[model samples]
Target: MKLARRLQAIKPSATLALNARAKALAASGKDVVVLAAGEPDFDTPEFVKQAAIEALRTGFTKYTATAGMPELREAVCRKLEKDNGLKYAPEQVVVTAGGKQSLYNCFQALLDEGDEVIIFAPYWVSYPDMVHLAGGTPVIVPTREEDGYAPDPAAIKKALTPRTRAIILNSPANPTGAVYSRATLEGIADAVRGHDCFIVTDDMYEKLLYTGEPFLNLGNVAPDLVPRLLVSNGLSKSYAMTGWRLGYAAGPKALISGMQLVQDQSTSNASSITQKAALAALNGPTDTITAMVNEYRERRDLFVAGLNAIPGIRCRLPEGAFYAMADVRGLLGKTYKGKPLTDSLQLSEALLNDFLVAAVPGDPFGAPGYIRMSFVTSREVLQKGLTRLRDFVAALG
Candidate 1:
């Protein structure tokens, strides 16, 4: 049997892999506390569910237009206008199965073989893999926890080249929870002006922010750049509709059309029923979103504070999303049960095996000496996980 060389350049998602391992451990009767999930723990709002039920009842379970249902795209446009202050028409939007597919579509639509995609380190686990699978080179630029994991505009500018096709931005990011400041976003927007590279902004966590400020979008900051920016968002995190699998991207008509063509050749349209549900999520009440954000703020404050109080674990205060990247660098060069605990991967294994806790190692996220813990669970479970984490770190010598 022959395997494609592309497979050699990619690894399975560390978050999903660890989640499966945790579920398996729990099924075996182990007291496994899994903290690797990236979705909100909240249930989908009743209104959204009701809308989907009605869609099914009305025989709306068939395929939609390749770009999306017209109304759904209109709803997405309204969301951008009302929420992010960015304007778009339905023709400039492409509804994807999830935000992931929008990104995949962008990679496929724009990237040629050996073209470069700029990605910030400690990024979403899937970005580089998506680039590689699309035959684009992923050029990773390092960022520091001290800087809140925000990509520097100067560094991004430095990474740009003739072959650079796009720069991926994820604010209120996955696994890190670092939201880009408005100034930073503006700087990025200003720097990339007139450049051929597109700014691919992933706003999956836009509504999940703990910050009091409104969601900062590059397109909103520099509307002139909107034609070159792709703002990809979905109802997964914000609306607690991960399984609903409806994501949409708004950008230039040409790019959106290209992404739609890629989607057309592949999955065609997103689920028609899910598209209806997403329409309700965007156009219906946002009170559910507010409630979820409030709960996540409480959990994040409790969990990050608890982690920072631990002897060797230090977690920065995350600005948004539901994750905390715990810096276990202080725990390295130490020993656990006569074996050297040297890297983030080894420490994550000890946490999973010996401590009966599951966490994704930061190595896969391009930030080793740390591990990511998601607070997308009950406060009780989070507290228990933190206690176990403390005990495990204390056992290290």
Candidate 2:
């Protein structure tokens, strides 16, 4: 059967592929330790879960407006204003199935054929594919680790062309765990403010920051460009409600409306119960954020330090997020178990099959010679995983 050609542009998620491989191995009675998860290991807060139960008991399971429930949208507005310093009306918000959907809706609504979208390398695996699926070309601008993964404004300017339609900014970024400082965000904002394009800020991991500073959104730092910015976030990461599939976006009324119309035709209004639960999560005690952030900070330190201690692996200390991107280039170009470990993909396969450790390789993320490991697991599990990783390196020679 012939499939739509658009589907051909979108690459299958590498994170999901490795995670599923690990799960399959474990299912087949192999002891696999998976560090590939993008979701938090923590369960949703009890209060949030109780809110969903209450909604169910009240028989509030009907289809909501294609955008979302009124209360949920208003709650999102409040959360944005309070946390991000980005003010918006409830009408400017659109809730969707998940943060992934919110981003997809934006791309579908805005991108024209051959439009260009700028992305950072070592980006989240989905950003490039989402742009391609929307018929837009992904222009990836690689960031240097020496600069702590902060993208340079000069480099961004060089990548811009008249075809540039938008840029996707992921702070406390995936794979690299790099947080874009307010100064850095403003620099890029200033660089592109005159462009006839938009910026889609993915702030999904904002609340998981381990840095000793408050989270900063690009929209908040550069208020002048707010009219052209779309802020996308979800209940999944911050609230530990990934399975609930609730996410939202806020932007200019026109863009939000366009996204809503796209949703109206696709999957209208994320699950009704999930919206209610998300509302509870936004309004309930944010003390949960502090607790979870604290635990993740501990795990991040342990994993980064352990990786750095290994003879061949070099790791960067992430200021925010629960991931550690380790430079495994030293282990490449060598033989592992009589097989050539020429690249990250082959290195990852060796790690999983021979060493029982699973990780997402860097090639799919546009940064070869590296591997991304989530410290989202507990300290005990993280210790064991790091030990296995270290031992695997030691035995590689």
Candidate 3:
């Protein structure tokens, strides 16, 4: 059976695949220490869950507007205004299945065939594939690990071309938790000044910041870019509502309408009950998120320290999010058992199969010499994973 040609250009999410493999091994009683998760281990706040329960009791199970529940869209607006210092009307917002969908809709709405989207290295795995699926090419600009994986403004300018349609920025980024600072954002704003490309900001991990500084996106530092910025965020990471399938984006009314149209023909409204729960999440107290961030900070310090202590691994203390992108380049050229540890993929496989530890390789993230480990699990689990990783490195010859 012939499949869509688009499938040829993409692969399944590396993190999800590793996570599933780990779960399967655990199901088989292998005692696999799964550390590839992108979601928080914390359960959804009870108040948010109660909101969904109430919605079910009140028979709010029907389909909502193709865009989303009007109230929920309004709540999204409130979130943007209060949190991001960016104001938007409900007409300028569209809620989709997840932040991923919100971004997919943006690309589908904005990109023409042969268009290009600038993405930084150590980026979210889905960005390039999503761009490919939308008939847009992904222009990867590699960031230095020493720079905290922050995108360089001059490098971005050098990558832009007549075909460049948009630039995607994920602050408190995935895989690598590099939060773009206000200065960094302003530099990017300066670099893209003459360009006609839109800036897509995925703020999925905005609430998971470990930095002592405040969260800032390109929109916040450069209000002029707000018109062209598509701010995508969701309840998944911040509110621990991964299964809720509710995410939203706000931009120009026309772009929002175009994204809404794209969504209308696809998975229409994000789940109806999830919309209610999202409403509660957006308007509810953020104490739960604060608690989660605090716990993640402790785990981050511990796990990163553990990785750095290993003979050949060096890990940076991430500024935000829950991942540690460890440079295993020093460990390369060695053999695990008899197999050569050639790259991150091979290293990841060796760790998972031989050491019963699962971590996402950085090769899929455009960083071949590194591996990404999530500190999203409990401290005990993190310690166990670290122990296994140490033993794996020690066994490599």
lDDT by residue (tens digit), candidate 2, 182-291: 88998899889878899999999999887788899887778888999999999899998888999999999999999999999989889999988999999999888789
How would you order the candidates by TM-score, starting with the best? Answer: 3, 2, 1
Q: Over all chains combined, what TM-score does candidate 3 have?
A: 0.98
Please, what is the whole-model Cα lDDT of each candidate in the order they appear? 0.90, 0.91, 0.90
Lowest-sum lDDT 10-residue window in model 2: 332-341
Question: CA shift at 41, candidate 3, in angstroms?
Answer: 0.5
Error of 2 at 156 (Å): 1.0
Relative to the true structure, candidate 2 reaches a TM of 0.98
Native RMSD of candidate 1 (Å): 1.1
What would the TM-score be for candidate 1 when compared with the true structure? 0.98
Best by lDDT: 2
Candidate 1 colliding pairs: none
Which residue pairs in candidate 3 have backbone atoms (N, alpha carbon, C) closer than 3 angstroms, thus clashing?
none
